[model samples]
Target: MHYALAPRTFLFSHYFATGLRIATGIIGLTFLAYFIADLPTAVAVAMGALCTSLMDMPSPLRHKFNEMLAGVLLCSVVALLVSLSSQVEWLLFTVIVLVSFLASMMVVYGRKAMPLQFAALFVMMLSSEAPSTPLQALRHAALFFAGGAGYMAYAMVVVWRLQRRLKQQVLAEALYELANYTNMKAGCYDIEAGLPAQMEKLVRGQSVLAERQQASRDLILRGRPTPDEEILVQVHYAMFDLYELVLATHTDYELLRQHFAKGTILPLLGDLIGKAARDIEAVAYAMTRNQPSRSNVDYGPELAALDAVLRDVPVGEGEDYDAQAALRATANKIRDVIAMIGRLHAATQASHGALPLVPHTDMTPFLTQQRYSLGILVSNLRWSSPVFRFALRVAMAILAGLVLSRWLPYTSHGYWTALTIAVILKPSFSLTKQRRADRLIGTLIGCMITAVILHFVHTPAILIGFLFVATAAAPAFLSIKYRYTAVAASVQALLLIGLTVPHGGSGVSERLLDTLLGTLIATFFSYVLPSWEYHNLPRLVDAVLDANRKYIDAAADLLLKRTGDDVQYRVSRKRFMDSLATLSAALGRMLDEPADKRRAPDELNRFTVQNYLLVAHMAALRLLMQRYAENLPAREVETALEAMFAEVRASLGAAHEAVPAQAAGQSTWIAAWPGWAPLQRRLRLLQRDAAQVAQSRTAIGAALGRD
Candidate 1:
């Protein structure tokens, strides 16, 4: 599993910024504890830094601060509560179960809050043994909270001093992703490339692009200067134009091969377009590095040569309409794309400008319901909601874990069992199972390392220093590699245990035993009314169908010359892109399910594959329309195409309604696309693809009968 690196994704500057900041926070706070308070007091302060690390998500300074602030309160509150309730085991158990349920439910609200919630849970484990007394516990929480605040302050200073550099990094990443998107789109035009697979590749790039763009926007919103903001708007405008060009670049490989089967020129043109896309991607790279763009290089000579060749190519008339019309449309689309690329290249090279306002992004905001509202809670009570099902499953699992720990007469580490359940048990069974395996494997390995460390590392200063390093590395690797994160955390746990209570609880074997017990309980309880992906598949299918309908509607308008405003076109494309991503993501989750739980995977796979192919065909027709520019289709041809798109929509609309119950049949979305007329080959290609979709849906319907 190779990850794509952005221009400066793993540069020394980033490493220095992240590693130095974390190391400073932990080491400074740890020493302050040793000199100003006891080593245990220092440990408390160091524990506060855990919240700081968890909030190390790559976000703007403003968002980062708020997240850290929330972390401080969550950890402090959870620590205090655990400390206060420790005298009564049952009360503490109840608290863990309730908190676990609520925390696990956080993702349904969105990804923004999940990390903070999990981090708070992790800190609660650390603070559980802090102080038995209320006053001492409060002091411990305060010290830990201060440790977190110190880390946040250090971060604030870094961002404040290096805002532009940080902003550049964000912008660079966004531009890099845009380049990848363009290249993937270009790949689809290559005659030999796999359409099904290329579209999947395109989806991956699009998701990454969306993430980077959001990060860039967040930076722009981080109280930057007006000029900085205008610069961001320029970057945004460039990407917008890029997408419009992408929309206009629609092509069908089969048609391309058919129309120019005997020609070297068409294939040469394809190769040239691919080269142009690469050059555009190079421009994106240049933007990231703050270097002058290669877009300044003239494209006129190469394109002028191609134009001479095209002008000389015979427009064999009458029966050769398919070849002539397609060739002309293809040439026009490529020409326009080349022009857009040059414009973007020039825009990227220019450092200063009175940037025009690009339209605002169609991104949805972080949604929150009334915090204390019973209404929000009540609304999620249905069995249909994965969130509700997950909450119940987690609540049950946590309660069972608490019981298991207590029922075992010899194990004193009941909290370890609870922590394991909290960390490993996800709403989805496959995900929970994966985490359980990771938890156990990571725990066993960590325990072995812990035993060796305890045997050889006797110097207190060295141990503290090692703890500092472990603390700094864990959260940094948390998203990159969860296995590493698991190891870092386990090492921290063992180090703290050896440091604070060496004489009383020094055995790594006991920690391993508790981890084993927790893994079993989490595994067993994961199936307590698990939220299977099968339950959610219908909605995903519905989303795909609906997005296609809207895209076709917008494309029909473009073809008919009803409107040239790309606002609807862009919106429809976003919906289609977003839906494709979501459906594919769900399919991946479905693959992770137990064999018995996956009712009709082949059907789901076909649904996805056909949708990808159909969308590609749709893009081709749109491209021809883009090339047509101001010329409306002949009135009769325009009416027939509009009718074709409407019937497709109506057919899919029926399929969508019938999907959840597994009652849909093949679509009646078939029309020959005026195959005999003087219509464009692009429309005929769309017609063929749409018929295939209807047939695919029928096959899918047969496959989904089990549902």
Candidate 2:
């Protein structure tokens, strides 16, 4: 928790673990070949191993295996194709461009088939510098394939062993969020605190729950369902249940403080919830250590106190006392939540009961859906696809750089321009921009370090040592920060070029100039066909609204406890979650854009906050319905609430709010319901809130729609 460590905390943990694993795999395969064979063979195999290792991201072992295999095949094919066509300049150029396009399009499949494969294609492009016969190309490609295969085998085993640890880590993260939510809940009783601030924290809690839910879903979906994995299934299922139970979490500071400001039981809820949170923290520690949980958690006293208070509390008189009724409902809800926590405590015990050191894998596709079909590949060619546009942009830049590098009379530094274009231009404008900056900074730092070493340390052995260290460190930093990766990689490249070619610091100056040229080329090409998030926001917002609308309808029906509705409810839930994720991604991209281009940033942020609040409110309603069969605002008031939400939903995709005059009698109907009528006022407030968001939406559309 020290201030200094907070900035670099992300550099450790899995990044460290996986970095060490892949670095060892890459360097080990490399040296093994080096000791037994010639330098070219050793370099080819090492390059193959390093490339494959880079693709080994966090995922199910099955996907890791496929990723490694794809790397091997793609590398071999690219090498063979380039070598075969090297005799014809035009043929080689066309082949590389087409292959690059296809390789980049692979990402349309899913997260599993992305940047790794793209890197593989470019590594092959770099390999074209080697002049070779077809037979030599095949031999080199085979060695590369063997290197990739060896590393793949090692990675599969390592991941298979480490997956249990990964799941435990996920469990700890859930508990961590549980602590945050509980602490937030405990502090939400301040009547004078800002409502917006309190709501933000509350929404954050739901967001945490959403993440836990996704983790559980991934766990269950990772492999085949069978009796052998029953314990793991139970653990994942418990997470889903825990997320649902936690969803009933909400508190209005003003209402609660007014009710308990002078009462003796003012700290009752906090006392109970705080104790439960500590118990979860203990379980989290056990999970972190991969140890069995302590058998007796004993939140019994807190639960007992809560039960006693709930038993003794009286309902107040008069229709003016609906607030009191709402307060009682909130108290009862807390009691139910305490019981749920006890269940989660028990589930934690059962999960730890059979914690296996090594887990099993089975017949799961590399991705949920097949992404390699001919149709999918062809479909990605449209301008609507960002990946396609990016691939085209990079290909165009590469070809132009090559032609201009020759005509500029600086053929020696020409490859640098293309190298920069390949490495820096990513799928999004903001990403490419960030990478460009990071690449320049990292390269400059790395070039300076290399210059110092080359000036003083001319011994071959020491230089090789530095090169080896840099090579090993590159993949490690790639996962943590691209800037660090770039630094290490640039240093390695400069060291190799200096030692092999015997240049007197010429490599350093050339790299700097080449980098500068590359940056200029990349920055210009980025504006060619930018995929700005501002233009994409409406679709993302609409998707979230549509998905949540379906979720609300299905959830409402489920609260009615109808049978045969479970299947539809689940489908709706997944869509709602997926849409939310997409919206978050778009927002992230929008925030990352140049400030001048980011119109209405404050409004966009508020829109996100409002959506999060909506999610928290809906979750609370669902939990209350499931636990107590209680209609939150009564069945009659729900009609008006749903109607209001409908207007809000329609406002998301359009530039104007839905008309209010059609609902002439909504206020009158709401007035008839004295028990939960106040919820109607919240609904009306939400409707009015939509108007502000709509205005911002119009302004953004105007800016982005300009040609």
Candidate 3:
């Protein structure tokens, strides 16, 4: 289905919902305070709400509440402290630097704490709006706390009421990404899109899919779901299995195109896969609307057509035979996908059965773990730590921005420069550069748009409506697209100031000037103690190898009947996928960096693809074993697989070592075992892929000047 056709599905998304909640809280509190008390009180309350709202992310209820509460308390305290010291210029400067450092340092605590940290820094910047006496500052802080707490309470209640719906939203999001991933894979058969480009797109999509799946896991796999929420849990499980099937569908696209360039089967296969993707998307759309999904397309015709085309192919030997086998396997995988979609649709209507009880002991490991302790912060205090360097960067940038702002004519709004710096500067140079560009362009566009509106229309009600929309759109798009967020934020900030402060003009020119200055400062400082992506490639490569090693062992264990599909095996698989995704993401960022900073682009790309194939081969092997375990010679197959696994493990462990010729040629015996031909073929493919990975690893070592 075309996404443009289903506007409500996108509107009901988790990101939009979060933004709308934040907008409602901010606008509701601001206008309510304005009408009941005064404009200043309304501004104070709105600032508080906005600060706390930054910490509102998709998480478990307990974490969400605690994090927002921490945001409210910290922001209020920061505002109060900064306000109390505002009378003394040097003291205020000291406070700003110290707060900036500490807040930026919170990255050591991981992602969840990031918003809380930013909330504190944000309030400090906002606190610079007006200097206040100690008594008046305390009153302002109290009002800030009131707005924050009030919004927190309101958000929690709203979340609680819609908790189930929220869970559905998150799960549906994963399905949406999975659909997108599948669609991207379908592009591989187009032949015209180019294999290298399609693979790059697929790799990037994998990272996004990994993130979405993790989010779904974090939410859906947390506490045991109630009976009413069981369908979501089931769909969640089915989605991951679907993702695995999609991964298993990976094959030599170059080979397929080379062999089938003149055939109709390739296009038919791509069309079928495309239809399957749409099927998944339709399910996601239904889930988003809290409705049961009914399949609207029949795949039988396409599958039959594919099968008929395959039947006409010569199936003796050579590339034609290999291509035929690959096409048949892919068609079967697609059939399985369509069947799984059917089951998934039924799952939305009613519970299939009780999901396997996840062991409590496995819960912590399954969900992304974050250590919220002082020790983590303390350990990251060293200069070698990226967080430490980032904190320093932020502090120095804030100081520079503050110093530069003092010389500007609009010195009263000098905090805008610092705020821009705070928002633009990130840990990595690539991200900072991207944010800098987005901030400048977004701010420029937003300024012109706001200026136009303010020039032509002066109706208070109309102006307030625009302000509400800009505010809502700001946080809503922050996670989705930061450029859009930047634009909305620019509009919102200008509108807020124009409405609140007396004789305040559009501030368009000032906004542009401050943003330009901020971006330049950010760009300059990004090179200061920057964390290069190449610096992390070796560790990430090792991580991928290690995870793959563990994954192979897990699959070996399962095949040998040494273990069931237990938590250990699941964790191993997850870590492998996660590591591969992490490596892919880092490579993506590295590509965006200076060309000189990119180490072994071709080698790294090969390494990433080899590792990806390794996982797919393992998944396909596991699936084969599961389906054919009853008929296969388990003992003999295990014995052969053990030898193969050892060779793969040794190659992974010693990056410089090539796969031994004897082991690489050991697949001859696989054909001798006629009873387990399917498993043998998978094992052979796995060995081949493992050797390629070893070669890629050795090349990476050479490129990186590693011994």
Candidate 4:
């Protein structure tokens, strides 16, 4: 019963809800137009609504409005141009090439421009399906704008109404991912699990967590929160602090496994951490439903049992001392995690006592900044630019597809071929290959489903219902999973054509064939001027190094009491995380490429893991200082921290430079005080991780031919 509820929580997620809302607006507007006016008007309005909906991603209310507005205007203009040129074959072909290149080039502006780019291309394909006179073309473009504007207005109202709820949903999503990350971290405590595989999964999980945290930042920190939204703001802050604590839990898991191989302590620790993950997941579930957390799992017994077992373990010298200290440190961090979870639940229940003060500094720097300037696009118009190469690749594929469609028999709906090309071909070969597979599989399944429905069910009402479901599911599943999106999109397109056109269902076979053709063309062109991930390794590695350096500098300042957790530190940390995620994602793509194209796979993997460990160690060091400041030698600790920071800096320096074998010998200062054993151990771990990072960097540089 407990496991059953978990699936249900995800099934009714915010993504699905947003999909339903969009479906409601689009179908509602289309049907009303069809009933009150005519089918043509309804079709125009639906096209406009659908194109504009592509831009309706999760963002701030103001940014959402502006983005949707841009979509409406750009799509409308593209429709008008396509309509006007459809009468002349050569002119239409020329327009297709120019439009494809320009639209694909919009990627220079980053992720935010992707939907707008697709919207323009989508409208062009739709408008080209029917030729129009200059005056009718004007009318069609106007209706398209009207429909987009209407949907935009409708969407803004819905967002405004559910603004707070949206914030909660995004925050809950981050928490849920954090919970998953914690569960994965628990696997490290299992003696049977392979540490290398576990670390790989953890790195991938970090990439996902970074993305979720950014989304939370964009939504929760966009503008000043009102009095009612203060609790959410506080929860948002607490969630990140909790994430740092989780990172700080990274210690010598292998060492612990070796020491506790025959005992029950390892399993006990894993069980405790796993339960904490579930507790977090429960809170996230409550947040999604806007209900107070009703957590039933009591950690008291588990904590007491773990404490009793740890009390029985002998605290001897050397390895025994290190193992015991690592275990105790992990247990203490788990306690901190549990306490943080309580605070999170309290915030949700509106208990505001002792909430952390929200940062008053400008939060804009923490949020990702996208510059929408023509200079960026123009600057990318070079052979070396990935965007330029991608644009050319897309345009060429479309042109080849067009020529093949003209030559092929029974190709009445050739525009589908072009549409498939536009959708499938991407800048990277990995994405193009994935999309090609999804498109073919999804189209095959959707066509079969639609055929079965059309053959058996003759009720117009049932067909319309299917149409609504498909329309809503397409956009909803787009971000969740592309294969699902492709299936729903295929069904929606076929149904709309069948209902509005003379013989839409009859083209199911043609749809499959065209998808195959598009896939083939896209696959062929993917190899043309492809921007391999290996080519970017130098820059990505440098970015990881630079971000880690800045992050360590900020962390050191905070540890030494020179700064608070100000915006600067937060920004540095966020940037570091972002860079790590970028590098990790790039490496993933590189691995997916052909084996010959992959560079430094082992070295890059090690570099990423070591960098991750370096950050975690620094976080642990900070927590150690906070916990033992009163008992330790303050001056000696500060001096040692400075030395440790220098060691890390030297290790992370340019790959060509020589790094010291040992920058700060721990025995010089750490041996003077046994009371600071925990801090001393953490410092030694930091130095070890830094040295490993340097080694990985040198290996990566050698593989890339940079050294």
Candidate 5:
């Protein structure tokens, strides 16, 4: 179980976030009641939260408006169906459940404006509560829509501010990562292990920057292209290439380390690596600020140093030769990268910040197969036993609520009990635990808030108004922080306490009793007959290893210049990512379990980071090879292909440990290198990918278990 530290900053942020949410929640809740005031408040509260939960935080304003409009229209139609089918309550409930599931499935599949989650929750709200009248149900639906709309407006303003803050924050973190890379040049070489995190963060940063660019694109469109955009893209591409070079360097380093005079060449290579890192940092900083003042200053200096180093570097005949030529080549790549950065800087400054357009054919042909396969993988997973788990959890919550209502003095108090349990009954174990703890605490806080209000003012309508404010604002406030579960529990507490006014009882006694009951029931059901066993990490391990095998096969085929059948390649890539995601989640769950319960004979399953990079490198190599293969000269390519085939066969034999050292150890690409087709230029790319996959498979097998 993960421990929740009472970090002072998080606590402070939670409170401020709560305040904002409460304010919007009140307005939203009140707006829902504005048109139709006959409905029970419970249904409205659940639907409101559901709406906020399903909304994408970064969706465009216009897109949100359209989605919300569609949601309202859909909900309205469903309300009509409920009115007609009210005579058969059981039938309606079944229909509601079915509708809810299908709509949610659609959301997951379509990834469209409409969120199936809202529709499902809306159905649940209506069917579970069994609203007394058509007007009452309609009123509840209206309030739910109003609450969601109000919070959405608030989210728009708040998130816009947050996005701006993130830019500076992430940029600072990127610079720090750059510094770390520069400082680690002399450490053990392990590119797949070492540089993946840095590159991943850069990829995420670029995505965020792209969002920011879109935000300002309209205004900047009339102006010339911004040098910043070009510089940023150039930076992005350069980082991509740098990451690849890092991987190649790691391989080269390992090879050299095995036989070279480390005392002679390692020092010089390390210095070159350090210098390249410095150049990267300078370019990153310049790109982040979109400033050119330091470009010529930094770029020119790196190029001068790189050129001097290359001129002095010594060349050797073989792969094992301990010459500095490879180091010089690496340095030259950095200098050429700097030249590209300079071009971007000039282009950006000249174009008023517009992006430089590259005319290219659609990557859709190559990437579509992979993308579609991934979609199917996600869809298949969603339709698995997890769906049953979610449904069962919902049923259990409803049962617990029914049981609690029997003991409560009032029905409204029981509603509170049930809602509380549902709030904390998350789909997974750790989430359930975290929400349970937060639920208990938030309930106490809500009780205190109501008690304090009761002491100062006793009017029922005033109490209702306060509860409304608390409920509506909870979602908006929780929107920004990880304090959502707590905020939600507190909101429910306030609403339930206000509901007690009609029954004429002091809410404190009922509040504590209901909270205790809800917590106990939720905790019991969560552990009893658990839906998934995190301890059995072997299941995930098995899947990952199988996927790794397929990935190896895909690399081998691609390396052989076999792009004729792309389906296997597509399947392999898709399986690789899905398995990776599964492994990541499984590892997390395994780590969460008690020490004895954790599976996987050893920590061998912890190679997720390395495996992920190896997969990426494989994909990149395949793409490069495909591009070259598609343009090869027929006759020349045929002869070169035969030669490459022989080397591949030798490597494969050696991979199985079935080839003699004399034959397998021969140089594979010496003569096949510059001879035949355009595709031959990228044949090395394919070979590198295949080599990494084979090497990684061996390393992982050694680390985990030999198959």
Candidate 6:
């Protein structure tokens, strides 16, 4: 048995891999038989099928694929009609282009963008130099449908096995975040920076899982993971617990900082805070791994000990951490979150479908602020003036594409240039830059893969099989966050090479030429659009100011404890968070901009990070102030609020300009307002923190360093 363990193990693993290959081979053989009468015709149909599958790999990929399919189908139908009427090439091309553009645009700006993408490709196919009789065109359309349907079936088979795995990953991430949040409150250090991003991913994963489940039902639902799906639904509830805990942490930290600034507590708490941050980071790392979570490390007794130490420690002010009862209230808030996590975890084990829609918390503010409706086509286009924007971007892209096309050795390179322009003319600079980089890298890698495949397997059947594997792997890879980079890279490679296969490229050099020209055009248009520069310093500064205003206004309302206005306050805070996210995105775009086009913001990205942190601090302060405000008289709090507001305005104005630090420990806002020592001291701390945040500018340095 020990003679050659590695070789034996490899062979064992190979058996399973080989089995899958055989199964796939059988599927391909069956499809091959249907179109055996004409090998070239069969090959064309197979190629189209493969492209559809590959394009459908990512969850979001469907929107693009659907648009392309719809567009293609529509164009094909129209072209068939026209072929029956007339055979003039110029007239056919013109009609196809007009119809396709209108159809694609209808879907793109409509509720779904998937159909529009298909429309574009269909239009291209119809208008291609290859002419066909009406019957022939109709046959091509039927082949396209057949290929599409075959791949759809293929997806159902592969995704059924994957659904369970994806469900487990999603649940584990949600649970880990929940656990980490609870641990942090017990004076432990734990930070999961990826938690927020993971939330977005999990939401998307759930959507996909739902779609797959529906597809499975249509195919033969007996094989689907019904029990696992139920558990996954319970897991979504567990996620609510995690979100609440994080929000509590934000508010708690604000209170903690204020308590410390009062100069009443020892600095011993800082080490514990740092430890909590470390613990959270560790938990985040664990969740990302495929392995099971480590057994719970119960720190209940340790927390009790820490609580005892805090109670015994003498304060100059002789006030407890919970003296104003703010800390205790925050602790209770965190406990509520912990209880929810515990209950949800139990429910997940029990296997449940939908839970009772208990109004545990109001998310109206978060939703209203973050999600913007694109509206119905006619209405949205009327508002956005889509035709005008489209023409402007198209013209810019065409200009850039033409410039790159001139340098390409092949005249056909212009088509890729047009495609490059289309991809680059998105709504935002950051998106354009990301897509450009992704497209270039994907194209390069895909072309190399195609070259290797052509050398080894020249036949259409083998090529189609290869495409199936690529397509199946795409969605699985794109399911996780870290894999997105590779997903984009893989997708670009596949799409470019897939499209070129029918054209019968001369060699690798020609393929490379097309890719390079496409990349050049895409990258060039991304920078030269002369649109609103996302990373403009003034815009960044303005965004920071706006976010600050929203945060302050929300914090004030929360502190006042106006229950009916919760939705408005949450909405305002959500807007503030969005603004911070926008600023971060802008910083990324600035890094990608051409050197000459990239202008440094006045204070740089330091201002952006500071503003972000400031908003978070304000959130925490709102939570703390509301709890603490409960202990004081209503009149006293109102008076203090007015004084604090004045101080914030003055401090903000002074810090608005970049200036050298002065050690006078002067007050920008505090001096202007006459107030009690406690109120003045609290306001002073905010000014100090805001100034420190604004003055620190490491983000810009980090961005430049990456270059």
lDDT top scorer: 4
Model 2 lDDT on a 0 to 1 scale: 0.64
TM-score of 2: 0.76
Residue-level lDDT tens digits of model 3 in 601-623: 88988888878878777777666
lDDT of each: 0.66, 0.64, 0.82, 0.84, 0.48, 0.46
Q: Where in model 2 is the C-alpha error above 4 Å?
A: 1-12, 87-91, 170-216, 224-235, 245-286, 293-346, 351-370, 383-385, 403-416, 449-473, 476-480, 492-509, 564-571, 594-606, 626-707
Lowest lDDT sum, 10 consecutive residues, model 2, at 1-10
- List residue ranges in candidate 5 displaced over 4 A: 1-53, 60-131, 142-355, 360-384, 408-412, 437-481, 488-516, 528-579, 593-598, 601-610, 613-707
Tens digits of per-residue lDDT for model 5, 259-377:
44434445444554565555555554453444542443434453555466556555555653333433543344444434543553354245433544433333232221211134543
Which TM-score value belongs to model 1? 0.79
- Candidate 2 lDDT score at position 529: 72
Candidate 6 lDDT over 1-707, as tens digits, reads 11112342222221223224323533473357455756545644553444344334222223333433543454445545544433664565455445434443443442334323433443343224256676766776566556555655554455445545434443443343333433334331112223333333322232233333322222221222364355444445445434544444442344454454443232333333333333433333343343322324343653465577557645544344333344444444444444544454354445244454324454333321112134544453442453434434545554455455667556554545455555445545655666666656655665676666666665666666665555434433332321333343344344335544654545445645665676666565554434445335455556666667666766666666655555566556555655655555555556665566565543454465445445545544554454454345456556566556555554455443553343332333333323223343444455565665544433443433444
Rank ordering of all candidates by lDDT, starting from the highest: 4, 3, 1, 2, 5, 6
Model 3 regions more than 4 Å off: 1-8, 252-255, 351-361, 410-412, 664-675
lDDT tens digits, residue span 1-707, model 4: 11212567755567877888889989988887789789899999989999999998788888898899999988998999999998998999899899999999998887889888888888988898877899989989998998898899999999999889889888888888999999999899898899988998899899998998898988898878877677788888878888988898876787888888887888888888888889888888888887878667788887899999988988689999898888888899889988888877877787544466674778888786657888889999999999999999999998898889878778556688888988898777788888889988999999988887777777778889999999888887787678888999988988876776636656888888998998899888998989999999999989989998998889888888898555677788888878989999999988878888999888998889999998788778777777766657777788778878888787777455766766544565456555478877787788788888888888888888952
lDDT score of model 5?
A: 0.48
RMSD of 3: 2.5
Displacement of residue 698 (Cα, Å) in model 4 is 0.9
TM-score of each: 0.79, 0.76, 0.95, 0.96, 0.57, 0.59
Residue 107 accuracy (lDDT) in model 4: 88
Please give the clash total of every predicted structure, in order. Answer: 0, 0, 0, 0, 16, 30
